[model samples]
Target: MSSFEIYGGKKLKGELTVQGAKNEALQVLCAPLLTAEKVTISNIPDIVDVNKLIDLLQTMGVKIEKVERGTYVFQAKEIDLSYLETEDFKKRAGSLRGSIMIVGPLLARFGKGFIPKPGGDKIGRRRLDTHFDGFALLGAKFNYDAGEHFYSIEAKKLKGTYIHLDEASVTGTANIIMAAVLAEGTTTFYNAACEPYIQQLCKMLNSMGAKISGISSNLLTIEGVKELGGCYHRILPDMIEIGSFIGLAAMTQSEITIKDVSWENLGVIPNTFKRLGIKLERRGDDIFVPAQDSYEIDTFIDGSILTIYDAPWPGFTPDLLSIILVVATQAKGSVLIHQKMFESRLFFTDKLIDMGAQIILCDPHRATVIGLGRQHKLRGIQMTSPDIRAGVSLLIAALSAEGKSVIHNIEQIDRGYQDIDIRLRNIGADIRRIN
Candidate 1:
């Protein structure tokens, strides 16, 4: 395992360009499986999770060509369906959470899909019921092997129908849309996830001859097509990374410019930072976060404490709540972070408490942070990264803390952020990766 040895209390400068959306890449990379024609995807992030998915595609015999650093052409012309039955496929697919998405396209084109229990961050119970339930609603017969911990679904032909999702799950909605695109009738999907990533997937499917409406709304209507063709698609910049940079700037008193952030797609992210009294400005499509000694947390209008919680899209993203919670630790006031979607995500706050932050882990789902206002600097210590988001959060904290910090299990951070230590180093951060 590798670790990051960070020399803290350093200011970062220079501009950083955000990478392509990791979540969108996972969804669109699977879209190529629905067609035999060439599907070109641009601005793909060179991150571990995305690369794993690409490797999985290559193993399935998808013709993949690297057009450039962040562009690739994929043609699923001669897929090795029999490979799915191999032990190698099980080990590979079971380790990746994004592998669950490929099942939809396989079922849509080949009438059958099989996946082992998918693995991802142990943040909380991320149930697969939504994905399989949506598949079952589309006329697929679902089966499970409890002893083997495997899931399989098959269907002669899928017929579209109304689906009111139990929750607005992003991946679940993407999977169902992929399945319904080639179904016999129109699928009216209500309470769907309308995040930018989802909208991008729908738009990409539409470009491929699938009829889809409601681009940015909860109600989506997809008319099943006989077959889908290929098209060119460019992914949006990762909002999570952009948000992380913003928090890093505030915590470390760094002036950083994030370039080409796709401003319009960053719903409520900028305003949420502003709510924390962090000064940032929009320069064209870029975000400029100025260096600050201390930022103040905003309270509710009725004089109550500021409570930031996660909800469906257009609200604050749960992914960034870890960053927000970490940023709040050094702010001028107190704020409550409510991680509603995941129960165990806030558990990482214990590490921050060790770093000298005043934090109250109210429960598994909530944390209250009383900012120190820079009166006392956080002293770095040895820590372990729990998940992708939390790893980055702890990295940001270490960068703003005093003395040396060793962060173990940096592989978790690499899963989401590409060359994070290198990027931070380029911006004048004293971070080194030790193998």
Candidate 2:
């Protein structure tokens, strides 16, 4: 087991470059299965999830080579689809939510796909029903056995049709889009997810000869093509990492600049940070956060105590709520945090509560935070990371606290953020990784 020991109350002041989008990179790397040519992806984060996916792809007979540290050349010219049924594949596939994404490409290329139950953060019950529903709309039949926990889908030829998703689930939308790209006819998806990650995936697919329109709207129209060609795609900068950096800067009273933020693609992120009374200056494509004496929570228009809620695209993301909640502890005033998407995501606030913050747990999905507003500092303590975002949130809290703090289960953080300790340390954060 590894842990991070942080001597707190040091402001983070330096310029840091953000990594590529983990979510988008995962889909792009897997999208190569749609073609039998060489596909290259750049700006891929060197994180656990990406490494695991690379391992899974290599095991499936796809030729993968690291052209550079963050660049990969994938040649699926000789992919063996039969490996999809192997126990080895199933074991690795079951460890990631992104693994289920390959089902679409595999079904498109081989007319069949088998995937085990996918795993990710155990925040709530994530169902594959929406994914299968998309495939079903594309003329795929799904069979699952309770004991097996595996899904076998078969369709001789996918024929695209109009699909209105029951909900705007990101992965669900991506899965359907992947399946529909090679279908026999036109496919129109309404109420689709239009997050930047989704848009990037669509753009990459389109670059490979797939036709997709309405990139920034909840409605998508795709004209199915018989075959897709291999293409090179660069993953977008990680917005979640940018948001985390903003939160870290605010909490630590740090004056830091985030390089290569892709400011235009960060829809609603700047405004969302503004809601916390955190100010950011734009320097070209970079975000500069000034040293703050204190951060204040903004109230609603009616002058009532406010609440930051998570929703689908065009709304705040649930993943960043953990960082927002931690930053709120040092901000002035009170705010309610409603995590509607994931039930267990906000439960990690118990650790913050133990650190002398004023928080009321409404239930599994809601919490009310009354900030101390820099009048007090959180005392150092030991903690165990429960999940990915929460682990980073704790790290930020520890960085701003008094004395020393120790955090365990850093592997969860490593699964998403690449060299988090080294990067933060470079930015003057007094954190050390102990293995």
Candidate 3:
């Protein structure tokens, strides 16, 4: 139970190189299980969730060697399937949301996969039906144990078929694609998630001899291969972290440069910030956000209030809505944040209201923020982090507020952002981690 003690009302100015994408790392770390040859990966973020997945893979007998910081080589030769029956395996796999992905590769190569109920941020109801349902459509038999809260799937051989997903779930689409790559026939996935993470996964699989098309579209076609080989893959910079930094700069009036952001993959993130009247420049592959005393929120063309909502990729990401809400607190106008995917994510706004931000929690799914235009500075107060995104959002608010603030449960932030307090300290922020 560590906490962050922050001295607020100071600007942070420095260069931050974004880490590798956390979501992509989770999906692609399981790719090694699809082959026995060595698969090398670089630019891996040193975070809790990713490390947990690596430990789980090592426990399952995947030979993993660290080439250097943020680089690793994994070979899934002679994986121990019997480990899946152990109590240790259950505890490990059940605690990680990313563990659900390994089931697909196991089923594709070994004809069976077993897992306990996976766990992650308690944001809302994230159903596993999409993952298992996609597997069932690919000729796998699915079973659920209500008493033990476990799931198991097995198949003699998978034959590819058409799958129209109920939702364009990112992880569900990644799991299904991993399984379909080794199936017997052509697999057509309709309404699949086409985020950069998914696109990278498909590109990685294609490099490994899997036939996949429609890299950046909802319709994906895959021709099953006999087997996959190994390849070296580099992950993209985390867009969520980049967006968070942009918000941090606007709220605290800091000039910060984020390096090598992979601009093309950012989608609508930059324009979304610009819509809030925050000024940022594109210097090559880097994003430079200038210091600002105040920013204004944009309204719709017909003179309606600006309403920002989350949708599938190419739209605003739900992960950054928390940052947007906090940034709006200091802006010159009002905006509505609609968190459509998760019902409980906006609940953290209560903490912001305590810090003197004018926010109306209209419901579980929406919040309306009226910017103070720096008319009154937010006063720091004690708070606790609810989840990863919300935790960072609170940290941003505390940094821009007046006086001292203590934030407990900083472990939530560490799960996603690596060495966050240390990074802030390097950028002239008065943040200290207390154990």
The top-ranked prediction according to lDDT is 3
Tens digit of per-residue lDDT, candidate 3, span 1-435: 999999999998999989999999999999999999999999999999999999999999999999999999999998999999889999999989999999999999999999999988889999999999999999999999999889999999999999999999999999999999999999999999999999999999999999999989999999999999999999999999999999999999999999999999999999999999999999999999999878999999997899999999988999999999999999999999999999999999999999999999999999999999999889999999999999999999999999999999999999899888888899999999998
Quote the positional error of residue 139 for candidate 2 in Å: 0.6
Query: Over the stretch 1-435, how does candidate 1's per-residue lDDT look in tens digits?
Result: 999999999999999999999999999999999999999999999999999999999999999999999999999999999998889999999999999999999999999988999998999999999999998899999999999899999999999999999999999999999999999998999999999999999999999999999889999998999999999999999999999999999999999999999999999999999999999999999999988878999999998999999999989999999999999988999999999999999999999999999999999999999999989889999999999999999999999999999999999999999888888999999999998
TM-score of 3: 0.99
Candidate 2, residues 109-175, lDDT tens digits: the string is: 8899889998877788788888899999899999997897999999999998999999999988888
User: Candidate 2: minimum summed lDDT over ten consecutive residues — where?
Assistant: 76-85
TM-score of each: 0.99, 0.99, 0.99
Model 2 misplaced stretches (Cα beyond 4 Å): none
Candidate 1 has a TM-score of 0.99
What's the lDDT for all of these models? Answer: 0.95, 0.90, 0.96
What's the lDDT for candidate 3? 0.96
